[model samples]
Target: MPQDDPRDASLAVKFSPPQTWTAESVDGLATSGMFLAGIIMVTRNRILAWPSLILGVNSWINQHPLRTKEGGTPPVGNLALAFFALIASYLPLFLKATAEPAGATETQTPLSFST
Candidate 1:
């Protein structure tokens, strides 16, 4: 005989919740931002500095050290680095003398800090 509805059985089928953006994605964003910031800092692309700083702050705000895979602490250092990079990117502009880039004209000079 075919059991139309096997309610008598002790087992029942279960379904997992659907996946969505989770903790790992946030971590990736944070790391990528840090790396990109480092690259921009090196390349002298000062205009792109703000995005990384935003990413760092966002990641820090969403940090969940307790729930992280390794249970590591929040990424305060990453944010700090981002902040530093932003400052470094803009540092030259505020100075009195500057070193022009390779592509700059002979007369063009970049900012340089003075005592």
Candidate 2:
């Protein structure tokens, strides 16, 4: 289904909702719903299925951890560690989505971490 839609373009632009929201909106809802469902499933010890689903959801959030000074006032490292775990857990899915295909036209884009 994802392969059918044009990359970076919303499916909503070309179609109207049939007694409900449009396809892109529907896809968005489905993605959100699946993510929540996957989280719930993971918490219940359903690792096999929820891991993949949660990865897609985590990529949607893409939040970065804020590191803090050591031996200062706050436990920023712990917070950052938590954030890293959250991001790491979903990294596989993000990489899969962004990875280039073999023999396909590859774009060399650099990602900036210092902001």
Q: After superposition, how far is residue 105 of candidate 2 from its true place, in Å?
A: 22
Worst 10 residues of 2 by lDDT: 63-72
Off by over 4 Å in 1: 1-26, 69-73, 98-115
Score each candidate by Cα lDDT.
Answer: 0.75, 0.43
> What TM-score does candidate 1 get on C-alpha atoms?
0.57
Task: Give the worst 10-residue stretch by lDDT in candidate 1.
Answer: 17-26
Estimate candidate 2's alpha-carbon lDDT, on a 0 to 1 scale: 0.43
Residue-level lDDT tens digits of model 2 in 1-115? 6656766465547654354221122234334534544454445333333444544445445422222223332223333333444555555666756566788765767886986
Best by TM-score: 1
lDDT of 1 by residue, 15-104 (tens): 553344224334787897799689778976787788889988988897864456555546797898888889888887887765666786
- The Cα error of candidate 1 at residue 83, in Å, is 0.4
Estimate TM-scores for all models: 0.57, 0.23
